[model samples]
Target: MSAPLLQIDDLSVTYWDRSLLGLRANGFEAVKRATLTVDAGQTLGLVGESGSGKSSIANALLGLVPPSGGTINFDGQDLATLRKGFPPEIRQKIQAVFQDPYSSLNPSMTVEEIVTEPLKVHTRMTRVERHEKAVELLKLVKLPETHLHRYPNEFSGGQRQRIAIATALALQPSLIVLDEPVSALDVSTQNQIINLLYERRDALGISYLLIAHDLALVHHISDRIAVMYLGHIVEEGPADRVYHQPAHPYTQALLEAVPLLDPARQRARRAERRGRVTTDMPRLSEKGCPFSGRCPHVMDRCTARMPPAFTVPDGGTARCFLLDDEPNEQGRSKD
Candidate 1:
């Protein structure tokens, strides 16, 4: 096996609340020692609820926010050490597509200018060459040459997203961090954008760290999936295994929450969920399992100590005490 394109080990990101006196009063860990990897030319879908630190991880990866601890190795370079301006070479190789297309692109800039901005910054391409490349990128995203002169406001939400994607591809980066790229679009448009991204990734041989709250949406495009809850990765494995046979309770609940197309199945799942006890937001525990309070299968041992990452039968790991009976080889602590 080759080295992963992006390797994140024990990554932690924290935000400090300041007092009026200019002192740090409290700190919140948005990401808690999270570890995951994205292999070359593979999409790693990171799924979690809002405030579960999905965007935090994305921001950290893009260098918009610094990690409080741990190492982020992107193609063998340490991201932590690049605190000063991120090296132009490194920056060029890692691009980003944000969620809100309207906000991500500048209204003043035409599609041609927006898409070719990266080329101008990263390469010594002439204006004519940049324009030609921009046209090609627009075509790659299924937009026409006529759309090049138009502003972002003139295009629909989906078209704007395509423009954003084209801009990201301008430099032919190795990895593209997509932070909820299609969450803002309508259902049909979302599918189109997802399909476009899937096609582009396969054709370009690029890796993606796709962050989204919907497991069903990302499962289609991702080669692997990781589930995050309250900042910790509770489960991770192949996309099919994680989607079809989720080993973690949170993952199961998330899957169950996705409305099924069949009326009967949807009703049945809804009724089943109602039968289970629903509680208020759980208080963060320092020692024991962070999910124990809301977990239906919570055991005494669950509250006593944090469970290790148990190897699931489907070739993945789940952080749950129910697997404690399994052999040591079948389970190991990430900590």
Candidate 2:
């Protein structure tokens, strides 16, 4: 197989909290030993709850936050070694579309200026060429040429997001980091934007690191899915397998939380869930399984040491001992 367009190996991002006197205090690791890959022209959906370090990964990729450890190899170059924003050429190949379109786009700039800004910075295109390209990009996002002269405030939430996406595509970046691209829009608008992104990605042959809380929404577009909980990847595999046959307990709970369209099924699932008591997991330490506290099948050994990634039958890996070859009395690996 060919090398992936983006390869993240044991990536970690930590934030330090200092005292008022500039004394060293405590540090919080937002991402811990996270590893994943995205092939050229494919989407990798990263699904997790808020504060699960999804945005930290996005920021690390965009050079907004530096990696505390590990390497981020994008298109064969190590991003962690940059020490600053990615160089001009590398920056041009990696673009981002943020969650809030209202703030992501400069409210003062016209749509033409906003979309063409990347072209201005990355290319030697003339004003006329930039304007023409901006019009084309607007069309690509299903917006009108007339809207080119309008400001962001003049458009609806969905229109603003489309404009943001157009800006990201201006340079034809190989990878686009979408940080909750559709979470702010209404349901219909969210679907429209998702479809627009899918269309653009296929037409342009671009890769995406799509971050969202909605598993079903992400699953619809992603070729693979990775689940994050409290900064660690608990499960990852093909989207269909992860969605249909989640091997991790946390993944199962997340899928169950998605409200079903059928009322009877939804009620039945909810009733079944109520019978199980779940407690919030304790503060994550450097050792042991992160989901032990809340996991219904958690065993004594689960609290003693971190479980290795066990291969699941459905072409995925789950960070649980249930799949081990020789489980103990509490369903933990004897090893």
Over 4 Å off, model 1? 326-331
lDDT of 1 at 213: 85
Q: How far does residue 85 in candidate 2 sit from its true spot (Å)? A: 2.3
Q: By lDDT, who's the top model here?
A: 2
Per-residue C-alpha lDDT of model 2 across residues 36-136, encoded as one tens digit per residue = 88999999999998888999999999999999998999988999888967899889999999899888989899999999999988899999999889989
Candidate 2 accuracy as lDDT: 0.90
**Relative to the unseen true structure, what is the C-alpha lDDT of residue 30 in candidate 1, on a scale of 0 to 100?**
92
Number of the top-ranking candidate, with TM-score as the measure: 1
Residue-wise lDDT of candidate 1 within 1-335, one digit each (tens)?
88999999889999999999999879999999888999999999999988899999988888888899989999889896677757888899999998998799999999899999888888999999998898899899999899999999999999999999999999999999999999999999999999999999999999999999889999999999999999999999999999999999889889987889999988887787795945757757877788888888877777877777887887778888776664344335555
| Candidate 1: worst-modelled 10 consecutive residues by lDDT | 326-335
TM-score attained by model 2:
0.96
TM-scores of the candidates in the order shown: 0.96, 0.96
For candidate 2, the per-residue lDDT at 22 reads 92
Question: Which pairs in model 2 have colliding backbones?
Answer: none
